[model samples]
Structure formats: structure tokens, C-alpha cells
Target: MGCLSEESPSRSMKPFVFTWNGALALIVKVSIQPCVTLFSHPKEMASSSSSSSSSSDIGVILNELTCPVCSELYKEPTALPCGHSFCRVCIEKSWENREEDTGYVCLNCREIFAQKPKLKKNVIVANLVENMKLKEGKVWLEVEVQDTEHGDVNVKEAMKSGGSESFCELCNGEAAKRCVPCDILCCEKHLKPHQQKGHKLVDPGVKIEELRCIEHGKPILLYCKDDESLMCVTCTGGEHQDHKIVGVEIAHAELKDVLAAKYPHVSQSMQSVASQLRQVQKEEEKTENSSRDAEDSLEEKGRLVCQFVNESVDLMKSEINKRKMEKLSLLGKQREKLEQQMEDLRQRKSTMDTALQDLEAISFLQDSKDLLKRLETMSDFKSVKRTPLPVLDFSKEENNLDGLIMLNKNFLEKIQKGPVEHPEKVAEGPVEHPEKVELDQNNLRRLYGRSPSLDPNSAHRRIKISRDLRTATRTGTENQYRKHPDRFDDFLQVVSRDCFSSGRHYWEVDVRSSRRWVIGICSNSMGRKGVESGLGGNPESWCLFKGNNEFTAHHNSRATDLSLPGDPKRFGFFLDCEVGELTCFGDSRVLHVFWGNSMDPVKPAIGVYDGSVHFVHLVK
Candidate 1:
């Protein structure tokens, strides 16, 4: 208060006149006339002084005024025709609706100004407004002190300063308003806007609850079969509505129980089946091994059988060849003997013819008469002293015969001269010669002139049997003949019973019950005849049995016979049977038949002995 001061304009007031100094000065004189009355009166001057002082204070205030639009003190205050002093933003907003052609209208007077108005600085009014704001701050503080002392710290203070008016937080208003539920204070204009628009508040809280649809906002309530997932109600009604749906908690409980009950039995069944499969596989392996072994054994046996059969056939063929060689050797010896005999007969016949020719020539000579008279004069030819007449000396003829006989003896000696030795062994004792007996010449001549009956003993000499002939029997019948007196015409006649002939001969034997007979061609004459011998039990005896239906031959322990069903007419010399066939050599005069109940009729028996017959079975 003490610093306040004012200047008086009344004391200095004075009147003044203007005079024209030049043509331009005349306009200045007229311009000063309006200002003359303001300084004429003392009372008017005092009032002017007070107004001047106030104007000066307003200038100071305006210098401190901060505009709400630009936030600075006003330099050139443009007052609208409304007389309000404001910055351009505040004034423009207040008059912005006025038409451009009419220019801005005043907010205070609601006056429309037609011209664009120019603003000038108002220092006094600006200073007043600044001073008031400072004073309000000081007073507001003092009221806050009083409220604190009274224990009312929450209370709002009264306004004592000058500035822009207080505004609501929601709507920016000056009237008092507050929310009791949220415990927030605001202006009256903003209270309803806060409740309805700013805060998300609703009655019953139901609309607020539905706003948050996140999964964590609630527990899962449904199962989605498509994805097999647990989902909330919002997801179920939206994305999973058509899928198979169930309560999540119920599905979980049922699935857990089923898995727990069935696992153990299924595992056991799988293990058992695996074991059985293993057993079957092992058995199959064993069976394969056994089959292989059996095949190997069968192959081995077949090889052995083939080897045995081959060896047996070779041995039999060897035996047959040996027998054939022996027969051929015997035939060679017989032919040599016959040739020698023929040579001896031819020489004897030539000598006899030459002697008969000599006798005929002597009878024809009649010239020796004196020799004949001497023979006639002697009364006894034997007693006459006579010179011997040369009878054709037959003694010389006998000497020629004797020479031939000596040559024959020498040949026989050559044949018998070698050691009397068996082929396989040597005899220990000296070989004995059989006794030599002479035949009567008269009996020999009778025998030589005719076919003589056989004598057993003499025939035995001609038909010499070999010791190798294993079976032979001799009959007792023998007939003997006397040789005739003429030595050249001697023969023997002998009759004998049937006996086994020696050398090699083809023989067929037939047996009927205990009887045996033999039919064969002798090797010497190739004769065909049947000779009955005896039974076949003795080791050194054999026979041939001849019957109407059956024929058999026995030698050693072996017996051969025509089979019961054999053909009789076709079976003769050079016949052979082996296996199931019968064959004959030479003419087809031999036959064989086999009619067994168990045999094949067409196959019967095998026969191949035109030269030789062999039986063989070839096994592969």
C-alpha cells in the first residue's frame, strides 16, 4: 500500500492555439482543434488526471498479460467492436461465425462490424489482469493454511485469484460435479459424460463380462472332436459348432480307465503268437534236412546195385566162353584123327591093285615049257628034286603092309608121348598102360563087313569119356563079333545098352517122375537119338528123363527140363531159354513156352541163343 503513487494532471493543464505557418501547416491546425477542450477545465483536468493514472496502470498490467491463445503479454491488443481485449485466437474463435464480407462481429455487444478492425495495445487493462492473478495465488495459499489447521485436509479451497475460469476434467466446465462410486471429483458438466462414455461401466456387470473372450478368462468347458481339444463356450459356438462335441472332463475320465484295463492281456497274446511262429519255422527246417538225407541215401543204394549187376553179368559171360573153347578144342582133335585114318586106307588100296596086275601078267606067259614039263614028270611036286619057280613073293607085299602099320603106330605114339599130366596138377606115380588083347581075325572080318551092333566094353574104347564129365552111367549090355580070316576085311560087331556119350554134344533131357531119358546129337556122327539112362541123385551119375509132356536132363547137381507148358514139336537141337524167351539156332525146329499164372503172356521168356544166349537186367 505504501508503494502506491499517482500523478496529478490538473496542476499542469493549459490551453493552446495553433497558427497557420504554411499551406501544409493549415491541415495540422485543424487536426489539433478536437484535443483543446480535454485541457480547458480544472475539474475536467482532475478527472483526466485520474483517468491518465489509471490508463498508465492498465498499460503496466497489459505488459504483464499472458494471452490464452499465444501465452504472451499482448503487444497490440486488437479489440473487437465488442470492446473485449483478447489475443487473436480468443477473439477469432468468439467472432469466427460472422460472414467474411461483413467482417467480425463483437461477442460482448453482438455488434456486426463491416470493416476489418485494427487493434492497439491497452497497457492499463493488461496490467490490472496480471495484478489480480498474483493476488489470487496469495489468497489461495492462505485458505489452504486455514483448512489444514481445522483438520479438513481433503476439503477444496475457495478461489481468490483472477485468471481463466476452472474447467471440468471430462467436459471442461466450471460447475461442481463428482462420481461417488469411483470417488473422483470433477466438474458438473463432465460427470454424466464420464459415467456414459469414458469409463466402461454398465448395469449388472453382464455386458462388461462378455467383453473379454480370451481363453484364460474362463475354464475349458467343451471338447472339440475335429481337433480333439478342450475349448471354451465361445470357441464351441463359433469355430467348432458342427464338430462332435462332449464335456472335456467326462471324456478324460472314460479314456483313462479303458487304457488301464486292456493293455496287459493284449501284450501277452502278442508274445505267445510270436513263440508259436518260431516253433513252426524250426520244424520246417528239420523236415527239409531229413528229406535231403533220404534222397542222398537212395542215390547211394542205386549206385551199389548197378555195380553188383554189372560184375555178375561179366562173370557169367566168362564161364560160357570157357566152355565154348573147350568144345572147339575137342572137335579139332577128332578131325585130326579122321584125316590120319583116311590116309592109311588110301595107301593100302593102291598097293593091293598093283599086286593083282602082276598076277594077271604071269598067267599070260606060255614060253617056259621046260619048267612046266619038270613039274609034270615028278610024281609028287613036293618030293621032286626041282628048282623053285618064283611065286609072286607075297612076303614082300606083306612087308609093305607092315611098313604102313609101323607108320600108324609111330603117329599114335606121337600123340601119347607127352607127360600124362593133368592141366592143373602133376601125378605122383608112374602112369599105367591098359592091358593089350588081340582080336580073332575071323570075327573081325564079319564085324567090318556090316553095321555091327554095339559092344559095351569095345564101344567104351571108341567113345572115350573124359574124367571131367561130372555125371555118367554105363549099361551092362555087350555083344562081341569074331574077325574073318582075311586080314584086310576084318570088322567088329558089338551091341551095348544106352550110356552117356563123351566129348562135346548137344543134349536135351526129360524127366518123368523118377525116370530120366536123354535125347541129343552125338558130336562124332551128328546122330539124333534118345537114350534113357537112370535117376539123377548120384554125384557121379546123371540121366535124361523123356516123357510125353516133360523132358529133363540132369548133370552134376543141375537139372534142365522143358517147362510144363512148353511146345514139344519146336524144341530140338540148338534150343535155349533164358529169362522169359526160348530161341533155337539153325532151322526153327525148336520151341519153348512159359504159361505161368503170374507171368505176362506176351513177354513170356527171353530167347537169344542163335549163337549164344545171355540174361541180363540193366538197372539205372
Candidate 2:
């Protein structure tokens, strides 16, 4: 391109230069590209200004073509696997100068390849750069056309030539259309010739140059499948002649369909994974809540136990103080009586002394009469015995108090440290014979056996208790028993006199004579006067019942049928207060068991609806 320059200092304008920092310097020499010439004519100057703007627009396009390594329009541009294009010579030189350990690397991205990779030509960048260079030449031609001065220029022609539009390749006029096959911009006059020559014409706004091949400068007609590159007709006739190829549109549509088919499954899998993550999060939250609740429950129970023990200790202390005050009061009364006796004795002695020391006969005679009378009284005083001293010893009470304290302390310690083990008992070997085993086991359990006598106070009105209070018989006639608060007024149920609150104990009842009977344990707080308080009718009691030849275990108003063979002559109950279990044993096997976690005291109970039931003496 040539430019005529007539220097004028007054009209001089600085040339605009585009610069990008941090890369190789890009210096494009298109001087006076957007500067007005010394035309003077307003119409010519306006056209010159329009040409300058078009030229500046081309400057922006050239910036994209600048290479990172060379900072110039791409020359034989090659692409690395990192998808960055660089001048082939420039990239080759960069890799050669790099350290051996770094391997072949892309200059722009620094992406490494283990071995030297083969370079691939970037047709898209190359074609775009070439098209911009051609467009720049046309822009210079337009500037040359607008530089010609004329006195009277057509207003319509100037207006039509005014804004930024692509220029025609042949005549440098503002482009009206683009030829797709030739990748050429054309004015209206040139478009007809191109159309007549069978070239495809499209709107000037369409980027026909982008679809053109770099090698042939023709529209891409085919996709070389093997090479995975777009090709022009000339490319197919060359090296890609025998390679698998298809129309570019066909390849594009097929690839789009493939992507469309895989998209939904991939999306669904992502959603499923997200759902599982949410479920895991919910489970984690639930587990945390459960753990927190368990900790709170443990803390609350510990506080309650401590409070109960403290209250019990306070009550015991109060009782002891009361007894101490009673003993002190009795001692005080005895002291008052002894003091009165001493005072009477001293007065009698003083009168006798005064009578012995008197010198006057009259005073002596009067004193003697009084003294004699006092002596007579004193003679009666000899019969008056001194009040015996109240004994201060409390040895028995002290021993009992110490034992009670130790027992409570041991119980608390056991709760904190778990059950205590007697090493001597644990060291004993097991019995060999089955019969001996049973005997020993029974004997061991009997160590805690209680001879529970039936409480006459708790017996029903229709129930008759023997004199020994061991057996209770249910008769048709009501006994003349007085109404008592502890009496079982509604049912023929009576509890034992002894209540077991801690440790383990076993008791047996002889129910062989009874055709219908119920034997079990009941809490001390169980109702005694109501129909709801029947043997196993409420939550406070549990029992094994035998009536009409059917055996069942009942608790909380719920009965569970038991399969027992013959009549069970005797029933043994083993109560473990700490473990909260009650096991009922028949003659040879266990009938059923009940569980209660309460710390309340429970007593062995017996209910006879027909015949009599006796409390068996297991210990004796």
C-alpha cells in the first residue's frame, strides 16, 4: 500500500497505536490509517473520516490474530493439545531452548507432554488471520478512493459510503453481499457477476470467511472423520481423498445427537448422588439427636438418685436428733427429783445442829420440839430411797446406727461401682453331679431365702389365715376380720410380712392342695382395697396363675399363656432387685419371668380363690 503525504504542522495528528501488555511487542505499520488527508473539501474530508473508522475496525480484528510467542499475525500457526495456537517456528524454538526435564510444553499454557508431540495446523485461526489481512488491503483501497478531491460530490453517494461496513474485494466499495463459495465480500455490481458465475451469495453480515478453508480459501464442504478436521473440496481431492468423510452439516448434526442422548442419564446420575448425600446428612442429624437425648437422660437419672440418697440421710439424722432429745429430757427429770431430796435432807440436819448449840432453855426447848418434829419427819426420810441414776449407755443403738450407715454406704458404692464379687465364692469349683448341682444351687439361692409369712392384716375377709400365719385358705363363709387399711378387701390376695427392697431373695409356696391359685410378687405401693389391685390386674404386680387346668403369667392386665405339663406342686420365685427380674420356678422348670425396673420394695404374694396355699419353709 502507498500513501501520498504533504506535511502540515498545524493539521498534524498523532497516529494511534494499539498495544497489549505482557506479550511480545505487536507493531502494525499502517501509518495515517485513520487520519484525515489535506483534502480541504468538506465532502472529501467526511469520506476520509469514514475510511479511517473502517480501518480502525480492522485493527481490532488484527489484535485477535496476534500470537503470544511472536505477537504478529499467525504464520504457519500450529496448535498444541492445550488448544493454544502459536507460530510453528516460534513454538519449536521455545521448546528447544527449554530444560530437558520439562518435556515438550505449550508456550501459552505451559501444558506438558511426556514426549515430543506432533504439531497440528490450526485451520480456523489461519483462515481468520488471512481473511482479516485481505480485508485490511481493501480498507486501504477505500481510503485511497475517498482521498480523491471533488468540488461537488453527490450527497447520496457520500451518505451511502459513510458508516463501517465490509468493503468489496474487487472494487473496494462498501460490500452489499458476501460470496460463500469464494469467501469474498462483494458490492451490488460485483454480486451479480458472482451470482452469474454460480457462486453462492449471502447477506454481507454472515461470516462466510470463517467457514472457508485456510489451504484452499473455499467454503468447508466436508468433514474428514479420520483426521477430525473440516476440509474444502480441494482438500478432499488431495491427501484426504481416500479418508472417511461426510458433509460438514451431517457430521455436526450427528455429534449433536450423540451429546443429546447422553445428557439426561448424566443429569439423572448427578441428581441421584445429590439425593444420597442429603439422606446421609439426615441420618447424621438423627444420630446426633439420639446421642444427645441419651446423655440428657443419664444426667437426669443421676441427679434424681443423688437427691433421694440425700433426703434419706436427712430423715435419719432428724430421727436420731429426736431420740437424743427424749433421752436428755428423762435425765433432766431424774436430776430435778434427786435435788429436791438433797434439799430436804440438808434442812433436817440444820435443825438438829441448832438444837444442839442453843444455850437458852426456852429457845432450846422450842427448838427441840421443832427439831423433834423434824426428826420424826427425818425418820420418815430414811424410808425415802434416792432416785436411781439414768444410764447414759447407748451401745446397742450406736452399733445399730453404725451398721445402718455402713449398709447404706455399701449400697451406694455398689451402684456406682457395679455389683461386688466375693472372691472366695467365685473360687469354689462347680458341683459334678446334676443332682448335687441342683441341691447346691438351691442351697445357694436359699442363702437369701425369706420365710415369708402371710400377712393377716392383708388377708381378704373371705380368706382364713392359720394361727402360724403361714397358710391362707379361701372359704365360702366370710371371716369376722376387722376392716384394716392393709387388708385385701376386694380379692383373696395376701402379701408376705417381709418386703425385699435390695439384693436377691428366693421364696417358695406350697400350692399343691389348691385347685386354683395365684402366686407372684407385688410392690408395697400396690393398691390393697380396690378391685383393680387383684394379683396381676395392675402394673404394680405380676403373677403366675393356675385355674381350670390352664397356667398363665399376668402383668399389667396382660396375660401370657404358659405351657406347663402337670400340676406344679410348689412354685419358687427368685427376685433380683438390682437386676429387676422375677423368675418363677416350678418343681423342675421355670414357668415364666417378669421384669420391673422400679426401685420400690416388693413382697411375695399369694392369692387363693378355692383351696389353701402354705408358705414353704425353705431355709429350715
Best by TM-score: 2
lDDT (Cα, tens digit) per residue for candidate 2, span 1-620:
32222231211122322212321112332222222211223454454454332322232333335554434467888888877677888677555534444567664445679988889998866764553342344332222222223233332234245344486654456789876644456677657644543445678787665767888665565677788998765565577756766556557887899999999998999999999999999999999999899689869876985886677567767766777788788778767777777887888778767777889999888677667876786534533344564555656445544544554564476579864343222221212332321222254243457778888889988889998889999889988988789998788889999998976687788987899998999999999877798988987888989989998888778788887668878888878676576767776566665767655799999999998999987652
Superposed on all Cα atoms, the candidates' RMSDs to the truth, in angstroms, are 46.4, 18.3
Error of 2 at 231 (Å): 48
Q: What is the C-alpha lDDT of each candidate?
A: 0.34, 0.65
Candidate 1: where are CA atoms >4 Å away?
Answer: 1-260, 329-620
TM-score to native of every candidate shown: 0.21, 0.32
Score residue 63 of candidate 1 by CA lDDT. Answer: 23
Those runs of model 2 whose alpha carbons end farther than 4 Å from true positions after fitting are 1-441
Candidate 2 local accuracy as lDDT? 0.65
What is residue 48's positional error in candidate 1, in angstroms?
A: 60
